[model samples]
Target chain A: MHISSTEVDYIALGASSDFRADGRHAFEFRDVIVESHLVPSVSGSSRAQVGGTDVLVYVKAELGPAQGKNGTEGVITFTAHYSSVTGLDNEVRTSNMLNAELEESLNRLFSEKQAANLERLCLLEGRVAWTLLVDVTVLKADGNVLDVASFAVRNALLSTLVPHVEVIRGEEGEADEIEVDDEPASRRLLLEGDPPVFISVCLLGSKWMLDASQDEEASMTSKLSVGVNSSGKVCGIVKAGEGALEWDGLGDTLKTAANMGVKIIEGLRKVQASRAETVGFFA
Target chain B: MGLREFDYGPLVSVERGTEVTTRERKRQWNELRPLFMRTRMVSHAAGSSYLEAENSKVICSVNGPLANTGGRTEAIERAKISCYISRTKFCGLEDDELEKRATTEYEGIVCRALESIVRVEQYPKSTIEVHVLVIEDDGSTLSAAITCACLALADAKIELRELMACCSVVNANGQLLLDPTLDEEKEASGSVLVSYLATSGKVSTVFQTGQLAYDEMAQAVELTISGAREIAVLVRNCLRQRESKDRGL
Candidate 1:
């Protein structure tokens, strides 16, 4: 999508005046609707819609041999795929770039933040463990896809049920037998507090705005994607766009993003708890 | 392929924290490793530089103001900046595929950082290519790549706002280690890389990973900026030295 010079100037002017095209304040976020446990086949699944952007996440757990020398912990990997109808005007190159960016961001968020305790997935030390494969699909792309994807991923992981594994000790040179219970009721993925969520803040002219729309993104100066958890801590940060940010504005942007991220996480948790029925894709 | 045919093993193994204690004893928490950098190392390229921060060694070369070959004819405004970063086989202890992926990710990061410093508007409808190769890697390769690329761009005589100086800080346990080594980086809970322009007191890029408190993040940024300032002085001195040599001083 291409915007004219007049459009960019108009967006900037409105942002500077604390007004947005969608009748939202500079710091206001679009209404986000989250639905979890929609896919029965997958271990966990969720869908998040932020305004026009829609994202689906599925978490699948597979039993595999433990990785690394200290193989007492499980592993989680993230991969993102862009559906053909998503965005970039169906350009393959840009879609591939976006896919790589989202995957890298998600992997870094989970691995570096240590949001979920992987020790809980370990069955036998240096032998067997659970490998969580998180696949994220962008059904629609308006804007703020990374933030929405993070939300869906966190919810999907939260709803994931790991089966209980019993390790029977061997007697006198016998191999230890591993047995996994296939019951539907299982333990939840142990998390360290609330998992971190990414909040992308765009610098529009002199003012910084949260949750920018696609039009706003096209006209924005720069963007900062900050990963913030419920405890008001930063997990990761990535800067995009060609524009430069002033030194004085960096601290303010980070602080505002952290505060907003915490609020969003709390709000989403409330929504998740209150959700009783599956809000399917069409509904 | 059979079920579970491929097992992508982890890069590093959990080790007893004993060796790290000894390593920490040798280097102060906030101390930086020795820095050795030189420009004009590659005669064939427009500009080139090699940077060695203790065990991490990086060579960067800058070429072009070449024609914009991206095929996007929609009225070019500023020159496009492109960066490619790769590591040699013997660079470090990482898998080949993983290293390639890492380099691809860093390509965007290094490109953006340079774009902020380079006066791209001066060369419209053109492209500037920066190629960085890691000859060796012990730790802090990303910071080394950025710093080296800046020197190469300057050597190429590209117009710029100010040279970018970058530094990395790793938060190990509760302590902040400046310019951490590979082992230290592996054991770190979080790390922050800041690319700064000391002249304008503005930061071009800030990439952070791992979990950190708000206060810790702020402190790390401040610390990284100061470290970058130190590197900026060294970079300036090196450039001055080159100028003196060219003038036969």
Candidate 2:
């Protein structure tokens, strides 16, 4: 939505006083509601709802030839699908830019950050490995879509289970034969350490706010998306928008984002630990 | 099997006795690769620059501020920028799809970084297009592309908020390596690239991948900024040389 200049002025005025349209203070985020393992057919699946934004992530594992120099390690690829209903039209270049930025951030989370140890997924070194395809679809986007998408991807990856594979040496000059154990009990999660979650901080007037709604996002001067894992380490950072940030403000923004990310990861862990059942979308 | 032939070959040798692959840096951690820059390399384009950072070579050309003939007038307040990045067949290891994907990603980053520094509002109802081609990509290709594009824009005499220089730092384990080579980058645990406007004390872009502690990430950012400052001086010198050459000095 194209917010008028008056609306932008109003939001800026409100932000200067630590007020927001949703009655949340600056540095506050809307509650994140997540449901994991919602799809039984896929290796793992999750749906996360943050404020009005809704995103779904599905992880599927397939056996494939190893890639590049990391022959002993498996590969995890991330692809984002923006549903047409999400109001992201191709004509508006800003939305397209947002989509590209979000996809790159997710790719960096798994491929560059080493969020998960992929060696466990390798069945036969330099020959066969489990290639995980993580697909994220944005069902609705009210703003802060990157954070919500990353949250769903991390949850989905945590629930992913890969089946055991036994490699049998073939006859001379022949390819190796493999057997996949399909027993439910034989499947197990291979990754160690939690994948990072993305936290976006937007400069609204003079205050840096978290989880800006679509309207608030339009009024922000610039935005920074910081990816931090549960262990209080920074995974990745991508800055967006047209506004340039001061040198001193960059440090403060990163510090605030790191603190907020750790707190949110802890909260998410507690929420997952206390969960009883899947209680998917219908519930 | 066909794609394997395009491989650039391993940078390290695996000893027959042990499996350790060791690579030693040729320069100090704070040292930047020797820079060679030239402007107006393409006579046809509005502005052009060819920059070589040691082995990484990039050529950029800027063509536009052309009148917006098509498309509905959406962003009339500021000029739009479209950036495209491509690599030559002999630039590096070849994977057609991967190269395409990398180019698109770099294009987005370069565009966004320049958008923040360029004075777009002055050229309303027009567009600025930047095209960058990588002749060689030893490492830090993204940083080189950014610098080359910035210089091209300046050579074109486009109005900008300030001249921006970019620097890249790679963290291998706990040690920070500035201006790492391809081998070093492959071994790095994390990497951070910062594009800074020294005069204004503003950061136009901060892109990072891999994982590091917050303090480490901060340190890397500071390192890149200082490194960028040094490069900014070099950029100024190159521009000055171009000016003198134009005056038949």
Candidate 3:
């Protein structure tokens, strides 16, 4: 097998206690820049740029019939598209994988039981329901796409609002009615309980690094990504790269990831609360 | 709803400008009087630029000189340049004929010019890819795309021994005009596209369609060469600005 000199250096760095070219600790993450209400025309939108990875997500709600099994409930469907700024050739495969992973992760988080509590979204019992479509796009891919994508999706969802609904009797029969006023009078999701965040750890040699760059990813032997809910629970886990991991290391990584996920959720909550008070895109 | 049709004219033609007609074409061109002629607009890439020839706006971004995934290791001295032109929504139908012609012409121009300027043998197994995304267009889009791609390549920190630029000249109503607009393009009798290297003052590529006299071709070449220089200067300025910004200067 052929490998570049950079790869060799990255492996050596991973083995040493003093890892990362930027001097960041193994558990440290790069600064994240998050912005909400980017697309004014859409119901809600948010963009997040973490390190070099960029993600934009928009939330739009439409009225549809509720499922027979899940009466008096609404639906939230998350669709993600990842496109790289670097060019189509380099990003096609990575984008597809990230999209599928993000969609699955979000679906797992917003279970039918949790969605039933959103009574304001349901128009009538087993009749009409509000379906929120969360569209996520990955414009630039430097590294850590999953984290950035999840951040944007969650932020967009937090910013989204579904209009008030009421049931009325018509001339023919009883009908479900939706009153969508210009004013922002809509219910917000209680995402504080079930919010999930993803943490990716790449094994350089014996040491694991958080938020690895594209070059570092190429050099690393294996990468373990863990999805943890707001309640410090491990929701999902996936391992990628060329090497295998020991059970002890995996267990330790999972514990570290859970702690990291909680920190992320706290940070997001702070941003969402403060951001909701603010008005304009640039401001 | 589908993509909306673009109206090139003013919202209120009588209030702002005269109506578009065959006889009023020259008058319209004379009135618009572009602020800048063939100026290089960007400067960060190995090559970067913008070609504002009349109403047409072309911005080019080039990135490479990093590595080549494929190619012979021994023949590393030469670099590979790929050109992509994003058509405007108004281009209407997406046809194979237009795409083939544009790609072939672009490949011919870039390949001929880079062959002489790039030290490809030094990096045998490597290639430099060039991508040109066109945000808007008025006329002679292909020629402008070639020029923009060259500038973007320069901005991307790629190594090129010389600067390459392209421009189009058309024959209109028995008179030759440099940088025709979309309206003029429809009525033009013939068109000549030329790509030139500023450092060597050499013509790398030339495509002339429709019948034109030898003297007419020479005149068009002369006009395009001078226009290329003006554009080269703009490209340099854009790069300088970006460099300064990057350095926090």
Candidate 4:
């Protein structure tokens, strides 16, 4: 839904009074719960629930030959799907749009060059590389699904452990291979350069609200979802609703989103650090 | 005059000497009224609402005022309207005979009611989609559906020339009951579904099933129109409340 221009003014005024319908301060973040290693069968999985929005992400990495012109190195790809249990209109289309946005953001965040630099992800040069598949599901939607999904994906990837591979040659020109280890070992991805996180902010009444509820979403004049990194860098942006934003408000919203993105990234890092041992689906 | 009552667990067998009592029926009707009333259910969608009458619960969501598909976009004279009804698992998740019949009946009522009030010529070929999801069922499912759909369209903030509303009437013994709940539905001899444009007091659509006298049909229609008017008043008040809140008055 598009936000109307008048609604934008209303929200701006409402923010000044600190009288949000959901009773939250303009900059206050919602309660977020993140659980990692939820899917045991998959290499890694995590679920994050923020308010009424629930997102689940599963990561599976396999060693295979890298495709395309750059065959000499390794590659990593991410795919996402959106499905709805409730029969809301345009659910499929909305899910598809979110999936495409996430895929593009992840690809841009972790390019082919970065994957090769990660070392552990690449196996036997161009012949074999680890292709990571990240599947995200939105079970219940209240608001701010993009942020919850991003957090789940990042934590799932952190909990993932790729198997070790070794290539050995026989004495008489016969090729041979040996198992280095059966147990999986912990590993970390090179995420310092681009830790993209998404923030969905809505313009209501006359103020821009961060993490709106379902009711607030209906009343919003316009909404802007911006993807940013730990360094306050924007990776992508999506705008919807019937409202217009002035240059000043847009700029302020972006700044607020960037700051919120950094806090989210820091929170995720702490979650990863606190885990002593991996928890599987049952746990 | 009393509440309508019927057993939802199992159908009772009636013998020559055993007949359903009027007092028992009124008792059931009184029990079901609260479930049929709902106010401002959906937060998203331009307009949204849900109502539970007896055992039936339906939620309606409206989305539109955006770009329409195809070459018809040029004929910006009137808006297009489309209605879809989905019955969820709580209302018996199986694809059975009763579900199909209920959907077909509700869809017809919605199409007719919306077409009557919507300015179809305004947007030429574009369409405004109205989706209704039935989450639970007790009885009078289709009537509840029509009411919910109209409320949703209103919630979506769509411009409607007139407000629409619907209700179901059932013939039990010699009397007609308004908004029959799930239990009353099981014992009802027949049912009539009706939708009305409240502003003009015009009957947009009507459907009846089972045997009924000619006078009964007229009475049922009258009851439905009156019930619809009551619902319309509630919807208007809710919208006004929301507007007042937005204006900070």
Model 2 stretches astray by more than 4 angstroms: A67-70, A93-97, A164-178, A190-192, A274-283, B1-26, B96-101
lDDT of 2 by residue, B16-102 (tens): 433333433345687787788878778788888888876799999999988887767367777999998888888875575444355
Q: Specify the poorest-scoring 10-residue window by lDDT in model 4 chain B.
A: B3-12
lDDT of 4 at A239: 49
| Per-residue lDDT of model 4, residues B1-249, tens digit only | 221132121122223324575534334432225433433555556666666554567888777755677643233555656678787766744465443343533454475567666656655546788888888876667767776776666666666677777777777775777777666666666666666677766555555544333344456656766776766665566556655655778
Error of 2 at A53 (Å): 0.8
**Which residue runs of candidate 1 sit more than 4 Å off their true CA positions?**
A92-96, A183-193, A274-283, B1-26, B73-75, B96-101
| Model 2 C-alpha lDDT versus the unseen true structure | 0.81
DockQ (0 to 1) for model 1? 0.49
DockQ-derived CAPRI band for the predicted complex in model 2: medium
Error of 2 at A204 (Å): 1.7
Candidate 4: list runs displaced more than 4 Å. Answer: A1-16, A72-76, A86-120, A167-180, A185-194, A276-283, B1-249
Residue B178 displacement in candidate 1 (angstroms): 1.0
Candidate 2 residue-wise lDDT at B169: 95
**Chain A of candidate 3 scores what in TM-score?**
0.82
TM-score of model number 3: 0.48
Whose DockQ is greatest here?
Answer: 2
Q: Enumerate residue pairs that collide in model 1.
A: none
lDDT of 3 at B104: 36
